[model samples]
Target: MFFWKIKKNPFDYLQKSFFFSCKPDVPSVNPFKTSKLISSYFKLGKIREAQKLFDEMTDKNVVSWSVVIHGYAINGFHSKSVELFSQMRILGFAPNSYTVVGVLVCARGLPDLVLGKSVHGVTVKSGFESNSVVGTALLGMYAECGNIFDSCKLFEGMKNPSIVSCNAMLAGYIDNELFEEGVLLFNRLRMSGFIPGESTMLTVVQGSVALESRIVAQSIHGLVVKLGLDSDMSVNNSILDLYSCCKDLDAAKKVFDMMECKDVISWTTMMGLLVNLEYAVDALNLFLKMKASKVNHDAVVIMNLVLACTVLGDLRRGRQVHSQAVICGIEYDLPLANSLITMYAKRGELQSSKTIFNQMTQKSLVSWTAIISGCLQNGHPREAMKLFMEVWVSENYSLDSALIVSALTASGVVAAFELCQQLHCYSLKAGFSHYRSVQNSVISAYANSGCMDFAQSVFEEMGCLQDLVSWNAIINGYGMNSQGEAALALYHKMRKSRGDIDRFTYSCILGACSHSGLITDGLMIFNEMVEENEVMPCQEHYGCIVDLLARAGCLSEASGFVDDCFEVMGPNALRALLSGCVLHGNVELAEVVAKKLFEQDPEESGHVVLLSNVYASVGRFQNAETLRTRMDKQRLMKNPGISSLGESSYDFG
Candidate 1:
């Protein structure tokens, strides 16, 4: 009886033998033939016809009810199907495992977990819980309802779970972000000799993607080839995505190249990943290849293409993508609009950015963030702060960490110190202060506003939870305030605390020593940066050391260091040495430095003006006049020095 009941198809047994010998009240038509016709109508999407025929059935058995219920469920008439199941129960017709499975599908569709649990009770009451077909349906229903724990319990209670149940449970695990456990179950099932079908392999590949395990990805790749599913588009797309997630671009490209029938998903996946992995130019090339092919572009693909353009800083191509997006009819896409705003802002095309931003009928938080960041980037801090105030005042949109950080940056640039304090308090009230980014931004804002006492207070309140940025902010804050001794003390204290010091930390500390004329400490720190921190001195590091030595009237030693380490020392080091020459009345050495400067980059007029001024300071008016004539001939214009005249104004352009 158990083996016989395991047969899933309701009409297959009837074809072999008359399982339902119906007594036709109307003798002209056969009831069994009528039931088969109902199923055919349902399959053909003729639900009204199927239901009309079902209503005509006077002698309805369990098979009759199950067929109509299953038809209605599969045809997307879930509420009606569930109503029929309830009516069948009230009519005293006992539901078999097949009937239970049909109603279970409806329960999942309606997302009625209460109905599903009640059905589980009925399945148990009818002893149909042991049936594989019923068990798999129940497993799927529970998994669909986000009740994986109950699904797992139900599976364990089953006598012998089927492959369908296993697959359902694996999907459940993936849904709940339990990929480690899902992979383990897959391996156990694979080792137990259950040959996964195409869908199972696809799910396994998805789980491996989440795990980001190279071993699992490669293993699945081998299985795909071994099982001859390499040509399966869905499976191939998933495998391609998995390889990219694992950071194995070579493997991802290989899979993409080997795809027999690449689809839009394949192109989108590679396009997005290439852009994300900083291979923006390659992504653009891939988009060109995709355009050359038969596949048409979608909104997501266009957005990715825009992103590639943005990353490459190719404003011409970015505008072209914008044009093509309209031609493709996705100009109204919100993500594309936001991407365009960011692209234009980054490329210094603020007018184009604001046009896209203003035309947007509906703006997301990203929209606000992008435009505000653009304002700040283009030196329009007043505009950024005004927009930020609107969001804060209206309370229409909830501010996220990124948005708040942008606002904090704007406030630091132009807003008063009190405004920065208020933003900090608001962040704390809104519970965004816990985010490391927000905390760091607040600290930097306070430090930049020349409020080290507040910066130090915030840093101390963070206690042991302080990040590298926090330490750097406070340390650099001290240095900027001309409290060089305090900055050096904090640096030593940071070392004692075993805090990780990045290259920025060295830059800050060296700048502190440079400002205070602590030449010995600055030299020792630069040596330690190379020997202990193993940090290769970048241009900033070299510039800071040159500034330190030059400021201390050590022109000879500073010039020698420039000669020795000339490779890394670019314009910054040269500028620092030239400033030292002007400060110390060394016209001879300034001439040599100016010669090297012209050899490297002659276009810079400020350095040349400094050398001319040095000659003029020693009463060499002829040389100074000669230099000014040469400057005019070369059309070398230096930016006029600007002084800050409170907010919303600069003394000069």
Candidate 2:
């Protein structure tokens, strides 16, 4: 009757009236219910759909804003979450505890310490500083930004800190590598009736893993089961990882078996443990077991399997895993790809590595580093330099210290002075000069390039900051250039400042003495090495001394030294003596040294070449030719075995 009283359009009018009359101000779709829909959308990974629905909501409150912001945060749209957070504040909407947590997650994604501090100010202004949830979020944000000092100060200022805040602080400590302090805090908290949650257990497990403290790991493991937190998947996985990292495979296996539901991480951790113990074959077997259980293969699991094969020197198995990864359609995974590159490089399959690298559509910084290092490791220094320069040309990567160090090594080996200068300038520009490793590599590269002047400059720039490696590199550089006096002087300077010189330091100094014919200095240093006993004289140290004496025409003294430490010197000192014999025309001494080398190892080609030269040097063409023929038929020759020092470093060879 009401519809007929109006008109043809009256029915539509009546429908609207009836619809609005019942609910009046209440929306047909409840804002809270709409918020839930957005959350559901986010859960389904429909970020755009959720955000659109949130934008269209006209009846949104603080809770409504929180839902979408939190959705963005959880979905890794950190910048968008921050943008929404800023918009909400500008629009005069006050954020609640939930909003603070969501925005703080975004803050943690941002590396700028200042942004985190600004967020902290907002929390303080909002009077959420003492609120446990907000305090935890704030603490985590600072810690993630590497501002541990402020995180500590904020935590210490909190009164009646909740278990969540305590867990955050503990995790922060572990994340920043303050492992010992984290463990100590856990001990103190345990005495104060602080019951740990699953997150807390995970953090504690991390601390124990970092310290590799077997006792602490076992204790925590017992606690995890007793407290029933082992039911948490993350907790279970972390517990397994802890036992594995501590090298307690039996305990790790026990935890693995006890896990009611194991994920890919659990399998990876267990396999990693086996690999660490050099039981890589067992690790492969475990992988087969994992497959039979139908967990499905992931990129990480396959990558770890490849590493296991690489470690076992099972190149055949490695190839099988690589094929499987390709068949599984995860061959392009960055980590898996990087592992394969290293595996192939170590196995002398550099071409295969280069192929894989060329096929990658998008390369990560790690990808670039892996290929460059692989090239260098495979003894292709110029190739390494080529790839490194490609990284610069690509400009997609921000250089890390390790990658820079590798490039520097390649540049030095190729002895490209222009490239060296460029790398030094680039390092200074890129702020990598602050890294001691980079500085040391630069010095070594400069020295290797025969640029003692630039090497000296970098060494002097290091000043008091020069580490043991820096000292070694500089001293070796001086020796390489035949500036024996300079090398000896630098070694003395290093001795005054760094008294705890290791075997390498002594080796470098002795090498300098040997190069400069400072026989007395070499003997004094050798005696000092013996006297210190801190760093026992190794084979290289003894070889340097033998070379020092032999080069000074003291074959009798060098021969006596070799006899005195025959057990310790191995075959290297004999190789040096042979070279010295060639240098000083002592054929009889050279033949005796060659016989000693053959006795040590019958397969090394180094001393064979040296002795052949010695025979030819004394106008014995027939003797040299016989030795050369035996060298050509390496395996067939019974008496003449190759020595370890192939293509000897001494110029007399």
Q: Candidate 1, which segments miss by more than 4 Å at Cα?
A: 1-119, 122-128, 131-134, 389-399, 414-435, 449-470, 493-501, 515-517, 530-533, 546-653
Candidate 1, residue 73: Cα displacement in angstroms equals: 6.7
Q: What is the C-alpha RMSD of each candidate to the true structure, in Å?
A: 11.8, 7.8
Residue 73 miss distance in model 2 (angstroms): 4.5
Query: If candidate 1 were superposed on the true structure by all CA atoms, what would the RMSD be?
Result: 11.8
Kindly list the per-residue Cα lDDT of model 1 for residues 1-653, writing each as its tens digit: 74575477647766545645654464666677888899899999999999899998887888888889899999889899989998998999999877888889988988899999999999999998778888889988998888888988987886667778889889988887889988998888888788888899988888888888898899889998998999899999999999889989999999999998888999999998899998998998898899899898789999998999999999999999999988877886999999999999999999889999899899999999999999989878878988888877876788889999998888777635777899899899999767878888888788777888888888888876788888898888888777899999999999998657888999999999998999999999999888875678899999999989998999999999999999878888988988888888889989998998898888989888989988988889899999999999999987664343454445353
For model 2, the run of ten residues with the poorest summed lDDT: 642-651
- In the range 145-201, model 2's lDDT, one tens digit per residue, is 888988889888888888888999999999999999999989998998989988788
Residue 413 lDDT in model 1?
Answer: 73
Residue 568 deviation, candidate 1, in Å?
5.4
Model 2 score (lDDT): 0.86
> In model 2, which runs have C-alpha deviations exceeding 4 angstroms?
1-32, 48-73, 76-162, 169-191, 207-233, 243-263, 277-297, 312-314, 417-436, 451-475, 483-514, 518-653
lDDT of 2 at 420: 81
lDDT of each: 0.87, 0.86
